[model samples]
Target: MAQARENAVSEAPYYQGLAKSMMFTIALVSLAPLLGYALLSGYQYTTAYKEKVEAHLRELVLKHDQSVDSYLREKVAEVQVLGEVVGGDRLKAEAEITSLHNALVRSHGSDFVDLGIVNAAGVQVAYAGPYPLQGADYSNAEWFQAVKRRRVFVSDVIFGLRGVPHFIIALLVDVGGEQWVLKATLDFMAINDLVEDIRIGETGLAFITNRAAQFQTTPRRDMTGEVKLLHNILARGGEDSILGRGRAAITVVDDPVTGREVLFVTSPLKDGEWFMVYQQDTADAFAALYRIRNVGVAVLLLGTVCILAMAFLLSRRMARKVEVADQEKDMMNDQVVEAGKLASVGELAAGIAHEINNPVAIMVEEAGWVQDLLEEGLQKDDNEREVQRALTQIRSQGARCREITHKLLSFARKIDPTVERMCVNDLIREMAQFCEQRAKYANVRIETSLEDGVPQVEASQSEMQQVLLNLINNAIDAMDPGGGELDIMSRAEGGDVFISISDTGCGIPKANLQRIFDPFFTTKPVGKGTGLGLSIIYGIINKMGGDISVKSVVNKGTAFTIRLPASKEGMRCAAGNGAAGEQPPADGGRSEETGG
Candidate 1:
């Protein structure tokens, strides 16, 4: 992944040039209608905000419709089953309704207002549930009449014989020319419960309406619980929206009866038989903009024009600045080349250090084990004992040489490599231990709070360690006397782990904090830094699928939080402060995929 290439693109003409000015003028002139149209559309939709409340209300209505349809269809299906069971005996039909009506009430709850059945004669022979309409003649009802002729019908909301707000769902039951009308009446109260989920602010109402503007559901605001409607415009045979059409006309109107001005937003629903109308108080919708008064509209339009003009002016100004920027960019490129040259030299330095240190580390561990065996009386021969003693000294010197090499390689590009899954907590702890002598010399104390079960992450061990150590060293260096603390902590989050390192030393200046991560950016005096430490650390952390953000208050301290992707392959690398941040050398380092 060559990042340099990601930013490479063909240049465009500068905005201050005559050609750019002409382009801008043309664009601004050509775009006024588009801007106006966008604003108008936004204004129309946004006016519906409080009314719709959320998308869930619309879904609830559709879902309730489906459920009701299914329930009625189930009853129609049962008619066939019951006809088979009774075999044309009207006497058994009443007894069957008694049993099934009780079952329906128990299953569907008290929401149902009426459950009744009629014989082929269309007289309600048996009825159950609250508001019993027994002995009533639903046989001539619109839904009943339709069902008598073998059609399923869902009649519009009406007051049943029980005088309850309910709708009739009926279907025909035929067995060998004998027939009956099976009907279910549902209370309008159920829809009130559905509408209750919508929230309306002060002086606002939430309600539903049919395509013809008949009320279907609304908030139970009044005690009467009556089915109310905008009755003036609702006509059974008046103008209706065409089917398959959506977003019909919306208007602010007085209900003529209620005399309330309402902003209505309607969506075609149930195949245009109805429209889901979400209405709110028109007064409340414009309440927020009241502070503007009569001059508001004029000011808004003027401000919009001024802002666009200012933007064009800003672009024109930037064209002049681009030339100066181009010069600075070239200077920066020269610096990059210079840095690359230094890096080439650092590579050689790194090669020498690594080649000299690897064998030394192995020898040191081997000799330590051998010396332990000798002390445990494993070696009997005096020559062997003498040889082991000599090897011990050689191993100690070799280990010292390895430490020297590590110190030399610390400032090299090969030192702080890229990241992989590693135990971040342990890595920070090792840096604390490694910097112990440095901290003592600088008279600073390092503390740690490594959270348990913190997941390992793909990160650069050396880079993160160097970052902590650098920040800690910076703090130690910043302190006047002795009392200061460098605290490091690591904790696991969802798919990432956060490592925070804070210092109790004097805080950074507000002006410098933002630029602290920039390349060669430092607040330290001459000879104290190359200033690439934090910059390199920043680059490495970002490259490792992680981010580092610093928060500081003057007179307090700075805390740097590094978030990394959790994974496991970098565990050993993190523990050893290995070259985990950089790509492995073409022939020298190992490669493996880590489990995240």
Candidate 2:
């Protein structure tokens, strides 16, 4: 039965494709947007949610801190007042001490469990507690020793006389140069009540621990009978944490005793030797958020199913229209490219000439460097360094020659799809350098005044380079051996950038000027001019949204003014010097115009 089912499924091709397409459509239309929206919003909410939780927790802890400070200060003031009383001669009598004890007991100060008096010998002389702690030796206790230093002392938490849990506050008196002590004690149970009165959340617990990690009070009912010992996790790690000894950090882990996940936060207490902890049960902390998330996801999924049905039909229709239009645009662009290549041979002739001279110049310079090194008496160390430098220069110069040859061959017969941005001023500078020395051979003086901040217009970098070089070479050819001036200036006039190449050569005749940009038009003797320079220049400038015009007079100079539109932006962004007003990258170069 299974073999028959498999064979039946294999026989159907269209069903498989339809199934695949449906799955694909559902995945993209439903899954993509839902995931994208959730992910983007989740990232933004993480920081905000954490801050909200932390602020609420801090408020609960701060209130306790304020209460603790207030309670402690009141007790300190009580101890201070007693110190002054003992130093007074009238208050130091036995009758005064007995009256004070009786007044305290009548007022329900039984929680202040102990009251004691010490004689000048630093021994307890009178005591008021269930067990007579009279004559007890308390001189060694911290409160007793501290009072000797300042006549008044409030000791930090400590075990009291008779080994009952009490903290002592003591005062010293000096009568006739002899010292005495008056001490009061508060049961630790009073402090424990303060800890119990703190009302925290249902899942949250608060507790206090001493400097020794010994819990002074805990909310744990099981641990009520004994002092709870808490571990400082970071103090134990020693190596992993920067928090030394007793310092605390928020801890998220399973509780060792209860086996439940706890989110614990700590605040400094007891001058930072102790930590006040607020622990929240992890399960309870996230219960509300989990409920909200589940409901949101269910609704989100149902709405997405409806959206996918509509999106599938819309995407299919739009995609088909775009595919057809793109194909037609591609064909038109191909025809425009072919038309540009067939326009000129003047560029070809100039490129071939430059290519031939490049190698000869390199050889001449290399030979000169070698001759100079030999004539200087070539010391071995200096000779070796000079030879190395010469080799480097030789390699670099050969590379330049190869590049020029490549450009010349490309100009001669090759047609390539070139794409680049050409700077108006930089292109003129490069062409002038390449052809100016050739002008020296003809005794023609070529002058240049290029404007600053010339814009970089889009075109093929190499193709536009050929166009400029060809124009400069043609101008040099028109000059005389005795001396004819060539002035080339590139500047922007409003929205247009103009390159004017004016030469004091035999001026163009009226009829010749009209035919200069026509394909294959030339005035030079046969084999000297390919008649393609002006035509190629015209096509290139036209494709670049520019126009070329000539003005000449008989026996005077001829000026060719080529005007092109300013670049989309003044400077390209990829260049290191791009500032706020700079141009951004052009993914595809734009078309320009040509003129006769």
Candidate 3:
């Protein structure tokens, strides 16, 4: 018991290691492809989604850039047309300017906030609409100086004399050899509406800024904290620096104030004097991509959980089965030891038989001499007749002892493993009679019901002997302490020979029936059973193309049935050798029963 415990403890680590190895193998195989696909697909989708968003933002910024530029150019052209048609001489008149402004307002709505005429000295010479100053000073104004050098000029948004945020379009005119500036203030709210309408998802909005980083139009969101960041972006000198370029560019940067990554799409406007930029938070722009990524991670996590669970369960189960098989193997090794002992006992029996043979021969010769002496003294006397009878009895008993010694030597000799065709009924009768002495000692009854025409089987004689002996011994052991009947039967049916050995003994339980033939499985007490007998028998029969089965009822009896294919060659040999005898009566051949 202690040794068994030690062996079990030693094997625990081996089984645990096996289980762990299996678990890791299963997990790696299952998760490799899943993780690879998720990562690969995620990378591809992110790249595509980001490119799509950048393209869309770039297109949006460019479209609005054209609209804002067109609005500025149209205002400049209107001012230039007024200067040319009204002739700077008439423009000197305040009434003529007022009538022209009213006509322009009637034609273009409030987009034309007000109109004015400024001389080369930067002083307003004529004014129209809203403000009261007809001669507002303009000598120091930036537009006055710019207009003197350019035919048309669009100014950045500034709080001018009106103290309101607005920009103006001015056209220079030559009136009687004098330079005159025709200026019209554009409605700041009108241009601001153009940029305000360029809204996208949450946190996405557009605004316009000049090269000086001054806001030219109102932004939809607060821009107080982003002024420095915008200036730095305008100062950049790469493809995304669109300050003086005609094409739009895109960039992504971290917002210093919001501490979030932002996407910027910038386009040149108003002859590169201003920039139309559309900025949006990157998270908001790619919200759908992030959502899909989140869902994929969730699914991957769930798959990992399931894979681990199955791996653990299957590995543990397989490991348990392996442990059981190993234990059975150890038990089979013990049975091999038991078989070795039996072989030694057979050798001892052979030695005894050799010794007894000589003695029995000498005794038979001496008894023959005594009988001859009695015969020589043959007389019609009672003494002489008694001597003759006694001598006769001694000779007959000596012959019986010699015969038993010869049979013992034959049985104890080494077995031959050569395969041969042999009659099944003959082997059955031999094995039954061999066990008759043991049965008698146990007060058991032995019976035989063999069909006369049972066909011969082809198999190794020694293996067949072992199979029958083991089965008979098991039956005898089952009936120990209380003798029982042992029945042996043989029949030829369906091209096969059937043999059955039954015993009225303590039978096997239903639960153990299926495992009875398994190596190392036994209900017998420890030393009394090695548990390999039935398994070896099963294997031998299977090797000869035969099969065995069993049936039992607990507390009643057990029956083992064997089926072997009948040999056609053996049948032909029997016929050629004239060994085929007359068939028995139709009542199922011969039956015999003998009490121990």
The candidate maximizing lDDT is 3
lDDT of each: 0.58, 0.62, 0.78
lDDT for model 1 comes to 0.58
**What TM-score goes with each of the models?**
0.35, 0.43, 0.61
Residue 354 alpha-carbon offset, candidate 1, angstroms: 99
Q: Please list the residue runs of candidate 3 whose C-alpha ends up more than 4 Å from where it truly belongs after superposition.
A: 237-246, 332-596
Write model 3 residue lDDT over 1-596, tens digit each, in one string.
66578769988999999999999999999999999998998999999988998888888888888998888777877788888988888888889889999999999998888888888777888989788867889888888778777878888898988898888888887766788888888889888998999888899999999976789888877897998888777656234444544467777899999999998877778767788888999999988888988999999999999999999999999999999988887677546634833743453354455555655666677677666766777564565666667667767767656555544444444254556787777566656665666676677787877777777798765567667767877788778779899888877789899999999988999999999989789787786566777887887788689999999998799999999999977762132212113222221222211100
The true-versus-predicted C-alpha distance at residue 477 of model 1, in Å, is: 86
Q: Candidate 1, residue 413: CA error in Å? A: 97
| lDDT per residue (tens digit) for residues 1-596 in model 2 | 46435644673454445545765786686778887887677555645665566566666665665565555566656655655654545444556656666666666466567667776666877766566777888767777778888776656566665676666667776555678777877676766677566545566777766545566564655533323324544234233334542233456777667767766666656455455666776665555554556666776677677666556655555554444454455455444334443433444455446666777677678768878888875785588588678777878777766655543443343233344456766556545654555676678776777777776666655466656666666666666555588888877778777889898887788988789888668777786666766776777778778888989875687888988787776573222232212222221221121110
Clashing pairs in 2: 345-532, 346-532, 346-533, 542-592, 542-593, 542-594, 543-592, 544-592, 545-592, 545-593
TM-score leaderboard ranking: 3, 2, 1
Candidate 3: what lDDT? 0.78
Tens digits of per-residue lDDT for model 1, 1-596: 24333423223443246437754775576457656865685566555653454343344444544454455456446544544454444522566666766766677676555566677766877776665567777656667766655466666666756566777667565544667666666677665565555555565544555544556665446412222443333332124444322443344565444566765544544445555555556666555533333245566567667767775666666665675587578567446534533543443354445555666766767677676667867556564766567687776767656554553344333243344456666556655665555566567777777777777776555556556656666666666466577777777788788888888767788899889988778776785466776776676677677888988877677788988887744332233333222222221221122221
